[model samples]
Structures are given as structure tokens and as C-alpha cells.
Target: MDEIKFICECCGKEHESWPAITYNSPSSYSNLSDQEKEEIAVIDSDFCVIKHSDQVDRFIRCVLIQKVNDHCEDLEYGFWVSLSEQSFENYLENFDNENHETQYFGWLSNYIPQYQFTNSIPTTVVTKNGNERPEIFPHQDFDHPFVKDYYNGITKEEAEKRIKKILKN
Candidate 1:
């Protein structure tokens, strides 16, 4: 396979290597209307919040690494998840704390292509004691094919194919 590259919009730098997929926002945010997004949603590279008349949906950016069967490179995803207000606040408060460590229950907010479901999936978002983004793990008992593939892994050819398809010319 050829090298995959993407220009980082966040840092305005070139990224030679790449994750299999990276989503800019949660599907919920994407579903909002233009005026709704401007009036009710606050989003950045790491966090997002959508305010509804009766509820506030909070989200955070996270990474999920998927093992590709018989492949040297794993399939990684930069996805989003909905968090409770408390969890979102805590994460935001400790954003600059390199030693902060915690965990939160979240709902997978991105409708990944292969794992598209009617409802958001349950997950555990783990914050590490460093600069790295939080990692999410799907609930093992969740009856979803995506969760199964996440644990069992995908074929190398499938992984490469997905990447090539995503980063099209």
C-alpha cells in the first residue's frame, strides 16, 4: 500500500501517516440545521455541546483503535461520544492538567459506516494521564457487529481498502 497523508486542519501541518478514519463532529451535530448549529451548538476539535429546549447533549472527541487481522497497522478512528454534563465539565476543567486521569460513560455519537445503528452505542471513555486524547471501548456485551469486529479485528485488505476509500483523490 502507498503512504496515506492528510493535512491537519487543527495544526495546519502535514500528517504523513494516518488513522483509518477521522470524523470532524458527531453525527448528532451534523444533523443540526445551519441556524441550529450556530445558535445551539458549541464545538471545537476536542469537545462539543448541543443545547435543546429541554436537554443539553454534551460530547467529546475520542480515539478507538481497531485491530486489523494479520496486519501491521491497526485501524484507528477519531470519533465522538456524548457525555454527561458532569463528565464534560470535568474533562474541560482538567484539559490543561497533564496528570489528570478519569473515566466516563458515553454514547457513541458518530454513525460509522460499517456500524450504522439506529441508536447510539454504550462506551467507556478513558482519560489518560498525558496529552493523548481519551480512548473509548465499546461495552463488551453490546449486541452489535461493530463491537464484535472491534474485538475480533478485521482483515488487512479490508483495513487498507477502507482507508483508500476514505482518503480519495
Candidate 2:
């Protein structure tokens, strides 16, 4: 796998090399009891924030896997990461020039492909584990055919326009 360097947005720590998965074990949630688990929903869940590069904002990924038949569509609910409010504002401020904007947004377009995307926004839900589930709102990801088409060939201006349309709703 290709490696990328980035500054940790959550910890402000600089990391060099490729991104890797850091798993937190089940013991991480061992302290929660049945009542607490009901209040939270999940058990032994872990959270991670993905920072693709120095220039790109962090993409948070928090998830857990276990066997359960519930209202959830899958065994796990995933949170797609995005820019923080302040970081998004900064991104907009630099979007006038496609070249400059692409440096940031291009990374976004490419980093998130048309797959692994959902219409849901990031939200907080108490899990059985006594932890809050990380949420992701609707947006284009590598999974969307339109978004895949857009990232594959569309220019920055065109991509921005499409993104704007999605944001309006």
C-alpha cells in the first residue's frame, strides 16, 4: 500500500509515512455494564481519524464489528470523516482558484472514492457499549457513480458545482 504523511488534526501530532489501522481491543469498553451498554448501544467500539496528508483535513473513521440483529442495516455502522467547521471555512476561502482549491479538494475527491459512501450524515447515538456512535452525513463518496465520474475526469469548478448542489439539501 502507498503511504502518506499527515498532521493529526485531533492530536496536532505530525506523523510521517503511510496510514495504518490502529485497533483498540474489546477491553477498551470492558468497564461498561448492562445498563450502561443499553444507554450506549455498542460494546468495545473504537474510534480513529484518518489524515491523508499534510494539506488535507482529517477524515474520521470510528467503527466496531459484532454479531447483532437490530435496526442497523449491517453488523456495524460507519462514520465517514469530513472537515471540521473551521477547516471547511478555510477550505472555502481558498476555493476561488481551481489550482489552489484542487490542492485541497482534489485530495478530497480522490481520497474518498465512489464506494464506501452512504446518504446518512454523521450523528451521535448511544450504543449498548455505553459509547456514542460517530455519525456521517450524506455526501459524495467513491461509491457514488456520479461522484466517481466527477472525480475521474471533471474539473475542479465542475466538481465544486456538483458538491454545492448536494449541500443545498
Candidate 3:
């Protein structure tokens, strides 16, 4: 038997291992109104980036899915943003329609420190369009401060330092 370990880039700490990362788009995407679709930026099909408009605010939801031997599990992470229309359009223009497994990084409004071993923390979205389902991994929810540091543009080094200080006490 062997033990696996991963050095987290966000917190700069060693974790036992990371689970396979996956993303899932809500089935509601197809049902969105044409106007809604116009305001949305489809990211590799698995993610829909809704811009901040008078009708709706900007936000992102990332789903983490894991597959074990015969079972599958999942959880959701998300955040709201205030991106400008131009920025949102840029993202839409850059979207790769052919590959659905595209990875996008954004700020997180919620943080689940328990999954520190995750390949990437809250901000990483792994698109699931045009790809096979992802493998599942064991997951657990632990208690920690729900920090908005990611949204504040805190670097991984700073986050890791803060986490160490918190855990040290």
C-alpha cells in the first residue's frame, strides 16, 4: 500500500491527496429563454456565464462530481460577481465550443477548507461538455471560516499563510 500526498498551491500545505475534479451544467440551460441565452456566456457548454444586467446579477456555480468504484457523488460551490459587460463579452468570445473540459478560474464567494486536497480550490471550474463523465472520489465536508478572500484577489501564498495562522492556534 502507498500513501498519496499533494502540495496545495492555494494554501501551500501538504494534503493527503486530491480527488478527480469534474463539472456539471444544470439541465435548465436548454430551457433558458432566448433572451436569457443572449445574456449568458456558454463556457464549453457545462457552464453558463450570466452577465450582470438589470434583469439579473452576475454569478457562477461550480459543481464538484466524484465517482467511486460503482457510485457517484457531487457537491456545489458558487459565487456572485460584478463583471462589466465588456469583460463578460470577452469571455463569451474566448469560449471554445468544441472542447467541453475547459477550465476556468474565477473568484469564490464560498470556501470549503475541508476539501483542501481538491486539485484546485473553489474558483476552479472543470467543464463537462463534450466529454465523458468524470470519476468519483470520496469527499467530506469540514467546518472552516467561509472566507471571501478569493474574491478579494488574495494570492495563494497569502491564503496559505493565513490558513496556517488560523490552524496554528
**Best model per lDDT:** 1
Report, for all candidates in order, the number of backbone clashes.
0, 26, 4
Error of 1 at 161 (Å): 2.3
Q: Mind giving the per-residue lDDT tens digits that candidate 2 earns over 1-169?
A: 3435667565576644322222232221334466644554342233222222343233333442222222111122243334464544554454343443221121121122323534423222212223233222223444555343423444444434433443443
Task: Return the lDDT, model 2, position 154.
Answer: 43
Q: Which of candidates 1 and 2 is the stronger one according to lDDT?
A: 1
Q: Identify the superior model by TM-score, candidate 1 or candidate 2.
A: 1
Models sorted by TM-score, best on top: 1, 3, 2
Kindly report which residue stretches of model 2 are placed more than 4 angstroms away from their true locations once superposed. Answer: 1-56, 63-80, 85-131, 140-169
Model 3: lDDT to the true structure: 0.37
Check candidate 3 and list the clashing pairs. Answer: 66-136, 67-135, 67-136, 67-137
Compose the digit string of candidate 3's lDDT tens values, residues 1-169: 1335767575677755423222233333435687766666453432345443444323334443322221122122222222235534444554555464444544332324333432322334444565432211111232222322222233434444443543454
Error of 2 at 61 (Å): 2.3
**Candidate lDDT values, in order:** 0.87, 0.34, 0.37
- Among all windows of ten consecutive residues in candidate 1, which has the lowest summed lDDT? 11-20
TM-score of 2: 0.23
Cα deviation at 7, candidate 2, in Å, is 45
